[model samples]
Target: MIDFLTAGLVLGCSAGFSPGPLLMLVISETLTHGTRSGVRVALSPIITDFPIIAATLLLLMNLSGYHGILGGLSLAGGLFVLYTGYHSLTARPVQLDLPKEPPKSLRKGVLTNLLSPHPYLFWITVGAPLLTRSLKVGPAAFVAFIGSFYLCLVGAKIVLALAVGRSRAFMGSRAYLWIMRLLGALLTFFALLLFREGLKLLGVG
Candidate 1:
């Protein structure tokens, strides 16, 4: 239980630290719109997790009866990672024109999260391993684990928002491009590793 909790915390923090499209969204929103916009973007993960968790649960259940489904999932996850990596590498940095009228609704944040496959792919490969494996943890421990995760995730986002707000010039388009490209390369590395493991599981290259 102790190990699981620690691992969960570390995993959550690591995932939150990554400057992916979501983090870019937050930076763009905060710099262009307001801190409120950044907050909305940050919480979009919570909103997006409902269907993803359900789908993961269903997939886990269905695949429990089969030997190869896990490998298939791993391959799919790898493909998604590769695609996102390519996008991140090639995608343009967002420059904010700052709309004169604010977006009154949270539609952009919500819709981006829901429509993207990244969250589902990430949770399927990475998040589920931490949460679902903690069979020894009681309900209280589970709650604590989840609480810690959200604390880390949200805390990171808040810090990022503030940092972007404070140093808008530093985080401007040029830095954004390089950071995103670096992240893309890192994600591509993850893709290759996962793909290799998936091939091993499937007894194929």
Candidate 2:
């Protein structure tokens, strides 16, 4: 249970802090409108992810009889996380060129999140398995995993928005590079764990 919670928190924070389209939008909106606008964008995942989670869970439940399929998905997810981690390890400071359009932060955020493939792939392959396993341990563990995930995910984005709103210097700071590298290491570790689990499920371990 503690492991689940820890994984959830780390993954969430890493995803939130990592440079991506959504993060760019958040920074752009905050720079243009205000911290409140950026916060609405940060909260977009809460609105968009419910349907995604439900659908991913349903699909996985229906396919639960096929361990091979699940194993394949685990491997794919592991590879995807490795890709993300590699990029994080090599990340450069973002060049935030604010868009000219007025900030429709909420609507843009919802659309961006919904259209993004990363969230869908993540919930289906990585998150679903972890959630299913956590549920068997206890409902509290399941809830803790989900609750901590979103809390850290949204919280990290909110902090970034605030920081950027105050000054853009934080983006180029040495601290930022260190944080990204640390997150990259954590993600790589999780990817290895997922890969091992995949191999075990495939009867290759």
Q: After superposition, how far is residue 9 of candidate 2 from its true place, in Å?
A: 1.0
TM of each candidate vs. truth = 0.64, 0.96
Best by lDDT: 2
The segments of candidate 1 whose C-alpha lies over 4 angstroms from its true place after superposition are 1-28, 89-92, 102-108, 124-156, 173-178
Instruction: Give Cα-based local distance difference scores for all models.
Output: 0.65, 0.87
In terms of lDDT, the poorest run of 10 residues in model 2 is 1-10
Q: Candidate 1's residue-wise lDDT over 79-194, tens digit each?
A: 87677677767857445444444654256667767877667767787555335534335566656666776776767677777777777764545765675576677667767766
The TM-score between candidate 2 and the true structure equals 0.96
lDDT of 2: 0.87
Q: How far off is residue 57 in model 2, in Å?
A: 0.5
